[model samples]
Target: MRVQEIPIREIRRPLYRQNDQNKVKALMESIQEIGLQEPIDVLEVDGQYYGFSGCHRYEACTRLGHETIRCNVRRAPRAVLKMHLA
Candidate 1:
């Protein structure tokens, strides 16, 4: 596991989620003011980055035009990723 800044466009979001607009707005404000307080968790499988959590934060950062995002990266096997997908 590691913490690093990754290009937001490189991450793959496999899940479809509806983010709370209010939360996204609040996060956008906080991120603009103090930067991202919490890094989003992502899985690195076969060198591919996959994001399954922190949907709100992701949306906020995306809307803010951030090129990269802070992430807590966990390298996992394809099987583990399949489990997440399933």
Candidate 2:
């Protein structure tokens, strides 16, 4: 998997579930201490990325005001990209 530092603003997250502040805080602490242990998965399309998983990790970084995050990017199929684009 290719690791890339993606801009936080360029990554889209699904809103199906609400983020837990407690978990986010814990995660943020872990991240601060150890750095991002695991890279998040992302689908790259048209220079932007969409996160399909790792929501908690994403939120933790967001709360930390991270400008970029390490991600495992993969080219998404046209159909999948279209789904996230809108």
Candidate 3:
């Protein structure tokens, strides 16, 4: 997988809405302390990136006001596509 830096504006929420406030904070701390343990996965469609996984990590980065995030992106799978469409 190729890692790329994508602007935060391009990131969309994942299928499941993640609103765990505590978890978000913890993740943010981890990110701050050690950087991202793994790159967030994304799917690109018509130039926009939809989050495929790593919702918590994504939110943490957003909280940190990251201009861009490291991502391993590819075309969306059928299920992943449906999630975005839903």
The number of the candidate with the highest TM-score is 1
lDDT of 2 at 16: 60
TM-scores of all predicted structures: 0.98, 0.83, 0.79
Clashing pairs in 3: none
- True lDDT of residue 63, candidate 1: 98
Q: How do the residues 12-79 of candidate 1 rate in per-residue lDDT, one tens digit apiece?
A: 99999999999999999999999999999999999999999999999999999999999999999999
The parts of candidate 3 lying over 4 Å away from their true place are: 14-16, 76-80, 83-86
Worst 10 residues of 3 by lDDT: 75-84
lDDT of 2 by residue, 1-86 (tens): 59989998988875465778899899999999999989999987777688878888999998898999999999877688777647
Greater lDDT among 1 and 3 belongs to: 1
**Which parts of model 2 have CA positions greater than 4 angstroms off?**
82-86
Where is model 1 more than 4 Å wrong at Cα?
Answer: none
- Candidate-wise lDDT, in order: 0.97, 0.86, 0.83
Q: How are the candidates ranked when ordered by lDDT, highest leading?
A: 1, 2, 3
